[model samples]
Target: MSLVLDNVSYRYPGSTHGLHEVSLDVRAGELVAVIGPSGSGKSTLLKLVSGLTTGHTGRIVFGGQDMSAMPVHQRRMGMVFQNYALFPHLSVLDNVAYGLKLRKVPVAERHRRAQELLGIVGLSGYAQRGIGQLSGGQQQRVALARALAIDPQALLLDEPLSALDASVRGHLRDEIRAIQQRFGATTLLVTHDQEEALVMADRVAMLKDGRLLQIATPRELYEQPASRAVAEFVGLSTILPCTVCAPGRVDLGFAELHAHTGSRPVGTVLHAMVRPEHVRADPAPGSVNRLQGRTGAQRYLGALTRYDFEVPGAGKPFLAESARPAAEAIAIAPEHIRLLDL
Candidate 1:
């Protein structure tokens, strides 16, 4: 099933903060991740879709059905919260079966379904254990089982793995994506982690200050960001202000570089954006776009080393990444430089 939010707007009763006119569509059987900084309305968007909050001024549709006026229980959307809201007093099986029991399923039938879901989440043997006895990862699995028990048309996950440790979170992240794909569930995942969104979602929706900035596939979002805000938020980037010197060229004060300045007139001010990984620390002697910058600081990050290349009058150092230590100069390819409006 697909989920769509059409120009949804909301405001707090006495405050001026809330989601602005936002529109998004999660395709059928596709996982769309909503990511942004704190107070960016990530959680509010999830709450509105799940029908936990109301009084929005737009349509919320599911599977071609207008669900704007539908009650929470009738929305047929399953939600997994960050806190893993499992009943501590209930055993794993009972916790997973709670939703089924609420719908009046027979004891034997609900238990059978619960057991099946537990097995799917890799908690079959722990079904009889108390929630408090399980680790954070295990508890989250039970919470997932409980949400899946309802067999929702759309699965809503609000930072579901945020509470787990790094190691456990990494494992559970893969597990959740596998399970989601296995069920072919239409999912809307709310997260503040960029890596999580990029790795698990088919497309990413970036929100800022209650507004939807951009929605695109991870590759598109990373490599071809729509604007400077989108470029800076999605990943590490060095944005340099410049003026269009020609049809496909920009002057960065210190040096003029070739870029994809599409149809912009000469002397038009713009920003040249490039990712750290795209900056070559040591280019061949006769390479293009070469800049002389003394290496300042270097940080070893396991597989790659991050270097700060400080050019004489560039205002700020250019960040570059390579597998080894950086030399005195760096080069940036014209194709790797993305031009954006200032």
Candidate 2:
């Protein structure tokens, strides 16, 4: 089912706290990732939708029905938690079938369904194993199986892969996305990992300090952010202070830069942001934007490389990265730089 929240506001009682005013729409069968820093109301948004919290000040509509008063159990939304909230004492089979048991699906039918779900999650033969016997990734699969066995209208996941090791986490996230697609479940994944959102979600909603920053496809959020905060949050960027010199240029302390982003009056102070990938190293002789700088720190990170290129009089270095390391002189394409309206 699709989900919608309009002007939803929530706050803890007693003192006047900095409240959150949230609004977004999740289409049926679409996967959306909610990302933010710690305490930016990501979990609170999920809690309000799942009926774990009360006294919300706005409307929640699900599948075109007013779900403002619906109770948690009645919502029929499947939730997979970060900690794999499974019964350690119970066998995998029982845990997967427990939700069905609560709904009083006949014993034989529920077990049959649970077994099917286990197979769907690639754990067919491990049904009899206890939760403690499985690895973190295996336990997470079991949690997913349980959530799926319900055949829920919508699925909610709260950092489901946070506990797993790096390689396993990467593999399992793909598995979860595949399963969600196969079942056509409308999913909401809450995560602090930006790459996870970019790789897995069809659209991402960015939040900060109890406010919604922007909601867009991963590319839009990265390439055309609405505010300086959005650019800083969505990816790695070198945000430097600059003044607009003309329609397509901004002046840093050391040199004038050409860019495309934001429309503000001349002489207005703004932030000039350049992504690590846009910071080009080893320019051709006499390149238009060529600037000489000393290299500070460089690292070979598997498929990619990163270097700190320190421009004279620009204070700190701008982060430069590429598939392979380049020569000392760096050049930035005019279109690669972005002026952010703060």
**What is the C-alpha local distance difference test score of each model?**
0.92, 0.88
Clash count for each candidate, listed in order shown = 0, 0
List the lowest-lDDT window of 10 residues for candidate 1.
320-329
lDDT of 1 by residue, 235-276 (tens): 898999999998888999988888888888999998899899
- What TM-score goes with each of the models? 0.98, 0.96
> lDDT of candidate 2?
0.88
Tens digits of per-residue lDDT for model 2, 1-342:
789989998887874443377889999999999998887889888888889887888898899887778899899899999998999888999999999999999999999999999999999999899998999999999999999888899999999998888899889999999999999998899998898999999999998887889999999889878889898888888888999888878888789877663567788888888899987778789886788878888899988888888889998888888886666688889888877776
**In model 2, how large is the Cα lDDT of residue 284?**
88
List ranges where model 1 is wrong by over 4 Å: none
